[model samples]
Target: MNDINLEKLRVNRGAHAAPKKRRSSNTRTWIIAGATLAIIVYALLPKPTAIQATQVVSAWPSQQYQVLNATGYVVAQRKAAVAPKGTGRVEWIGVSEGDVVKEGVVLARLESRDVAASYQAASANRQVAEAAVTSAENEMQDADRNLDRTTLLFNKRLLSVLNLQDAKSRKARVAASLKSSQASLAAARANEQLAKTNLDSTQMVAPFDGTVLSRSANVGDIVTPLASAADAKGAVLLIADLNSLEVDADVSESSLAQIKMGQPCEIVLDAYPDRRYRAEVRIIAPTVNRASATVTAKVRFLDRDPDVLPDMSARVAFLSQAVNADQQKPVMAVSPTAIVEGEGGSHVFQIGADGRAHAVAVQVGAVLGGVRAVSGNLKVGDALVLAPGSKMSDGDRIKLADAP
Candidate 1:
């Protein structure tokens, strides 16, 4: 009674519980499978490609272009402070500021009354000296004739020795007086010329072909050699020879060997925007500045500009290759801002197909003016990134900005 009754009771109670546990296990197994499948699908999704970059391009072949990028001042090769040669009062100024002038052309005038008076006085003195010399010569001639007669009489024993001696002394005195008067005349003549020259200084003239930069005096304005508060003095006018216009550019001391006299160059004047003038390296200064270690260079213009004036800002471009099969400055041209310095040294970022920047180490040469001369692995037509940090990488792809 005990085994049969207990077993039947337990089986009837647990039969429902066994099926519920099996169903619960099946639900857990399905949830675990679904979660794993979701993770696998997420990991297998595709990644986004690198973004493309924009770069600026230059028309020049990189190797053929040699640019000497430097800032400079445009200066007239022959600039001068038109000063008075002598002290004088200004009567008139023939030329004004910005007026063009030729050599020896009168530019101003000074009051020459005193100088003229002195000239006349010297001329009068010279005439007096000449008349005195003439009178002495006549007296000497008379005395000489009298002395000759006395000497002949003495020789014939008809004249006394004392009388002949007196006549000879008179002749000698007159001869000496004539010589003295002649010297006085010559001195007077010299004085007259000096006075004339001083009078001539009243007129100012152009020293060379130049443009008047300033007129310190006007008509009726008095100017003197010795500066005075009352007189407009010192530089009466600032004149500059336009024919010898040049750019005084500062160059890095390290780039001296690459520069030479007569090297072809291009110049851009700040006064004349966007116009490039043909230029040549007239001289590389032998001296260097101790502070900046920069050498000042004198560059010459092949074509003179009448409008070019002193102290105008300028830029010189040293060409790397012949601009037109003509010898020119060594300008290795690249995008104006293509040069960027990074860990790999001064380099150009040549964006590659993999959308990364390939930093090409470049040896930069002298920047003659606006053109930057660069050498090393960069080729003429290779695409380079102008903006370094903008979407640039070692192997990044680059797209050109629109034709503008």
Candidate 2:
């Protein structure tokens, strides 16, 4: 029972136990307390619904109140299928498709060898007629001199009356010959003009200033005035005045009452869908088509484009009123995705001031420019939930992902 014996007894009695087990117990208690506190905090905090949002914006004034829409084509009011005045083989073509030409510009030429030769001959004959006219005038002058001399001789009794009469007859015959020569000269000049005209007819010229749409004849193709032959080209070139382009649309007879001449219109071409061309009603047909029960109307473009060509498909939006730069007004418009279907009938989940969403009943009007025109208790800058989730409810908190 000495000191050594006491130490051995203390070791066996657990007086030197490891400190790790004690530390582990305290850690377990702390962990449990921390977990309970985190749970309580999460339960008391608000749950924000993550969502996509957009602001209601204004629509274009022209689109804000569209009366009607009709599909049509971009057409040139001043279009022509140009051909030669006379039938002949095409000798040369000066213009290709898409060439801009001025009025009376030579576009093509037909075979004119015969016509040119005839013209040359007529010109030579005209020169000969001029020479004859000059010679005839000289002879007439001589005849006047002879007649004067004969009259003087007859008065002086130096010549017999018969001889004086014979001189007078000679002068008269020369005068008649001069008169006949002048008539021949006049006829020759007329023939020259006619031949020149025929030669000019062999060349085709533009009727007006326009862009060439197509070239129908090759250098060797035969072009005819009447296009009677199967192998002959009916037109040398198809051209149109680009400045005189318009949209020809067919409107249902029932909708004619809603339109009139000089009405403002917005034209959208298929080639330039993003851009809008300002237009106005130019013509309305007096009668309706019995087959389609539609009336044809022409809409003239106020603006022009190089890309716009004849036969290009277009859409015409007949507006309620004219839309000018100063006349455009802001409108309450929302994206199509913002609309929600519910038992309340066409409602929107508008973001509230408190970061919550509240149901707002909207009376939707026209869908314009991919945005819907709506009348509701909404402002221009108000944000609305786009494609709301099923779990979303009235007064539910939401966190906007981004500004639209």
Candidate 3:
């Protein structure tokens, strides 16, 4: 009875163990199948496409009409190095760099004590000469009266011929003395005028309405008209007429034919790249530069800004027509390659912050240089995919080729 019971228990345990093993094997098979399925799905999914990108920028409408382009510098057509006419040590500087001055405004003064003293002496001598002329006139008048009386007495036989001749001789001598005194007075007046001129020269004055660019001489520096001396300063101040500011652009000789007087232009300064100035061609240099094969075109600004300074690096765009007030404003622009044309009109793929491309419908306007004007949900600094492929769609992932 014990043997039969033990054998039955063993059989039951083996059957239970076999079913458990089968269950475990089934779970392992399901896990492997799920992992393989996941791998296949991942392989079928579209991957991110690598693309080049460019930034949308503000562009001028005048760029559409640009016929030629050149590079140059801002220059003041009326510029001068102000120096004293008379050589002397600098005494006082009334102005420094960036001081705006009107015409004939005194910019600096030289040591003028000697010139002032000379002028005073000349004035005193003029006074003395006038007094001498008065004395000579009085003596001449007296001599004339005496001669008249002597002539009357001689005619009445009350005076001898010798006395009459002597009276006439005295009148002649006084007249000669008066003439000498008048000549001396004229000389003294001329000397006084010259001395006054010299005194005036001691003050360096502005030749025109301008802003002072630099102060080349100090209070103690010696200034001279000709900068021949090693220690002497030729110019006390460097000044420029801001109103006369213009751009001197160098255009290739082959492109000179397209430039004309009064041709409208857009000036972009390197110092202020965001700003644009309206300008027109003022002069086309008659001669060509032999070395550079270029001609200088002088362009005058129509809209003046105080910040426009001399020698600022600039780029000029010579336009076929003038830009009006509305056209001067900047418009959103993108590279031509960035635009994609389809049956639904023009659109651009703007990369979103989520690293995905979003299609933005745009209304294309005039072409601005190498870019095209577009108005849409775009801004000046939005990144746009350049030369998007036909397969590119909205919500596609993008990898920037320019990224490190």
Candidate 4:
């Protein structure tokens, strides 16, 4: 009876285990099929393209009147490369780079010991010649007295003819000696002046009131009038009158007619684009560069700041008239990249709040710095796609790559 019960239990366990294995296999197959279906649906769905967007802003009214544009550099009309008068080792420097200097202020000094000594010797020689002149004059006075006495005696027959003749000859000789001494004194004075001038040359001074741009030669460096040798230094320092700063721009000859003396201008430095400098045309070259067909123009700054430096790259916007404070008022503008040429006209892809693009027609105007003025159905706060690429269409959704 016990054996029969054991066999029945084993049969019941086998029956339940077979069905569970089949059920688990079916469940795994269904899970894999569901995953594959979900992937197909995701692959066919529409996706948004990534894009960059920017907001519209106002532009200066004066920018609209810009007739022409040119690029050039800031130049100091009174700049100079201050060099020594002669070759000498630099002993001292009184000014450094960026130091403000006044005209006649000493900027540096060469090893002037030798020149100073020569000047002292020349001064002493001049004094010696002066003393000799005094001595010669005294001797001539004594000779004149003797001659007068001898003449009186001769008239009284107390002196012989030969003695009177001797006295007169002596007086003439003394006068000759005095003249020679005076000539020596004059020559000595001239020598002294020459020595003094040479000594002064060793002490380099500012040629004009300006700011020092660089110190080409330092202490112990051998500086010369010119860098004739490879080892020799040329200029002791480079300086420029900051107040005399101007923009030397190269304007195309075709646009030369747009510029004239005293014409209003807006200057923008490449280094500092945010700062706009008011300027006017100071000179327009009478000739044009044949090779480039560009005319050089000098523009003077109406107001300047310390940041304005020589050699800074700059751009000049020639205006039709002077810009008033109110003319600086902003206008609706967008980046030039936002504009796209179509058969209809120039248009921009303006992004609406609904995440869709709307093609809007615009009248493009003068391009200022990085943006161009555009009159259209747009507001200052409107968002527009930057560099709208192909496949972008009206009502197409976009995923902004960046925040405005």
Give the best candidate by TM-score: 3
- Cα lDDT tens digits for candidate 1, 148-262: 8999999999988899889989988888898998899889889888888877777778888888888776666656666765646666899987788899999888887777888
Off by over 4 Å in 4: 1-55, 148-164, 329-353, 356-404
Q: Model 2, range 179-238, lDDT digits (tens) per residue? A: 888898899999999999999999889999999999888999988878899898788899
Q: Could you tell me which residue pairs clash in candidate 4?
A: 58-331, 59-331
Which tens-of-lDDT digit does each residue in 21-105 have in candidate 4?
9999999999999999999998887776678988898777677678899999999999999988989999999988899999999
What overall lDDT, based on C-alpha atoms, would model 4 receive against the true structure?
Answer: 0.90
Report the CA-based lDDT of candidate 1 relative to the real structure: 0.73
Ranking by lDDT: 3, 4, 2, 1
TM-scores, all models, native as reference: 0.64, 0.71, 0.87, 0.72
Q: In model 1, where do residues sit more than 4 Å from their true spots?
A: 1-63, 226-231, 325-404
lDDT of 3 by residue, 238-258 (tens): 999999999999999988889
Task: Give the CA lDDT, 0 to 100, for residue 105 in model 2.
Answer: 89
Superposing all C-alpha atoms, what RMSD in Å does each candidate have to the true structure?
15.2, 7.9, 5.1, 6.8
Give per-residue lDDT, candidate 3, residue 111: 93
Q: How much lDDT does each candidate structure score? A: 0.73, 0.87, 0.93, 0.90
Q: Count backbone overlaps in model 3.
A: 0
| Per-model tally of clashing residue pairs | 38, 0, 0, 2
Residue 57, candidate 2: how far off, in angstroms? Answer: 9.8
